[model samples]
Target: MSSAFRNRRIPTILVALAAISAFCVGCSDSEDESDSTTTTTTRSAEGADALTPFVGTVHFPPVPFAGSDGKNHLVYELSVTNFTSGKTTLDSLQVIDADSGAVIDDLDAAEAHQRLQPAGSRDSADSLEAGESGTIFLHVTLDESVAVPKNVVHKVTTTAEAAPPDLRTSTAEVGPTKIDSRTLPVLSSPLRGERFIAADGCCDASRHTRAILPVNGQTFVAQRYAIDYEQADDQLRIFTGEPTDPKSYFIFGEDVLAAADGTVVGTRNDLPEQVPGTFPSGISLDAADGNYVVLDIGNGFFINYAHMQPGSVRVKLGDKVSTGDVLGLVGNTGNSVAPHLHFHVMDGPSPLASQGLPYLNDKFSITGQVASTADFDRSEGTGIPLVTVPGLQTTEHSDQLVMDQNIVTFG
Candidate 1:
């Protein structure tokens, strides 16, 4: 009986100790035993018979904001470390879902090793120099339909192309789910820096862009004659410089606000702003639409506000914005002759497919004259002759000029 009792007590004590160790010390590798048996097997299979093993890790950044599609997508960043004696290259990467074990994403470096995929699995076709490393990025959508348990396991696999080609794999588990929300401005300044026109033609036909004026008192002109945009960045820009005047130099940098709520789907911020100029020395960055912002407004529709000021952008890379949120001030940044706000709508993420969508100004004042939407384009639209308030205000009829260009010309 004593022996039997001791046997039972031994198992009970071991179980208790294991439980305590798990709770107190946590689970981590405590030994550095080189499993030569496994190593040899893997080496023989990879044909690297002489090459050693390299290990690395992958991580992802948080999502910028929720999309109008009601789906939350996050960008993943992956890093790899090489421990060999020479350099190597990787061809591709793949990510597998933890719950379903399904492949989530894949990335591959293409010709000249330009494109790099996000974390998860990588190709074994590329060579990795000993002690060399690489990184990549990918976009992944979160699964919202499933209920996850405490700790879920995920698997990652990588394939490489090297002197001794072999397959590399890794696995990790995801903890609980958490959602975070933060707010920031959406629109951005138009004038980025000094840029040259990449192509010719109007908005959709050209590859570059232009800027617009946010304040009144700036004079803008149409492309006088289909002129070449080459060497336009070196031209001199005209500005009104008068916050209250309607006839002045162009406004390049002003405060811009968000038109709606949405996450930043795409952004290109490093473009140089074009200098103001006329024929002979035209603006270089001349493109139709000009410097602008494209905001996703849900239901496959994106609103674009173009032709903005330079060096006026305030938002960072990833930020969420609300309606009427300040994005940046308007100015002539791209293929613009004068300062003007160019608005349009598009179907896809690109502005090239954007169609001229009609938008109603919540309220605005017309100081000089009023022109119908149709007649506005003929003579740049007639100016509003009335002072706009909640209701209306009486205006003096002393001004007799045709207020074209939808502006309220003040004298």
Candidate 2:
């Protein structure tokens, strides 16, 4: 459980208050004075928290890192529960720099609705019923000129006329968490070639970063920092000939390199390749990362290279590998829709259960950017040239996580 979840206390006093609070939402102004309920309460002792209408906790402390956009990003979620007895409408939120008293970001109601998804539904919403839970997806970017904060907190305010007239505009402090300061691993390139596109990658992309799954009774975003690398030719085409043929891809059978020196902890080399053009049907969860390898890259970090060519994995379990060593060849396999390398650094050996962590490429050159995921998909699915943002500078970057849609060259 998150620390914030454990710290919130609602004893008997709040339980009685919750019931009265519910009745008070629909109570008329002419109701007897004796039936009125008090909504505010404060403890007399110093540092004691008073009762509040909502509770929120951050499931994972974000590790701030610089991205290809040349800015520092803090990407994480705030899990919340409505403690009020009446329906609560989220008004707005302000992410504050708890130490410097600086306002980091202000999300209006519409923006909140776009990012806030309820517990069970995939769609986003801005309101929750009494005792309901939801999650707020947040992506905070700090400009290159600004300093990153050591800690951050949220100010959650509900809509006016929500309940208990006096508490209509109440603001509560929630999800205060210390920022993780550990340095992200600087890794060598996992692939070698020009025009290697960083698709469905970090910061705000939906396909990878927003892929949250409930596994073993806990929720995890294993692909939060994952990058699906696909290559394009000089004509900006993902494949030249038959789309179904794995050999048609520019990166097919290319060597997959170890990003860091580490001992092989887990591996699979027998899963057959899936046909390109669409996702395979009915893949079990255990086979999601088909013919893959996991490396313990020291300090509790594991790197996963998934969807490799069947029988191409060169390293076995317990085999020690060094940076730039050949691990396998990229292939279309497992839950994959096409031939691309699915790569990510996780906190655990099991790719599905661990939280994703950020990593920096030791060096790489940016070549271009795909206009959008749709454009890349269309070009990959059909034999069309990829739509790209023109005139991107081909410059080498050092020690930064690549962002979404960027076409890069690796050594």
Question: Which candidate tops TM-score?
Answer: 2
lDDT of 2 by residue, 171-229 (tens): 66778998998988899999998999888888677777877778899889888899999
TM-score for each predicted model, relative to the true structure: 0.32, 0.86
TM-score, prediction 2:
0.86
Query: How does residue 356 of candidate 2 score in lDDT?
Result: 91
> Least accurate stretch of 10 residues (summed lDDT) in model 2?
39-48
Clashes of each: 90, 0
lDDT of 2 at 380: 83
What is each predicted model's overall lDDT from 0 to 1? 0.35, 0.82
Weakest 10 consecutive residues of candidate 1 by summed lDDT: 224-233
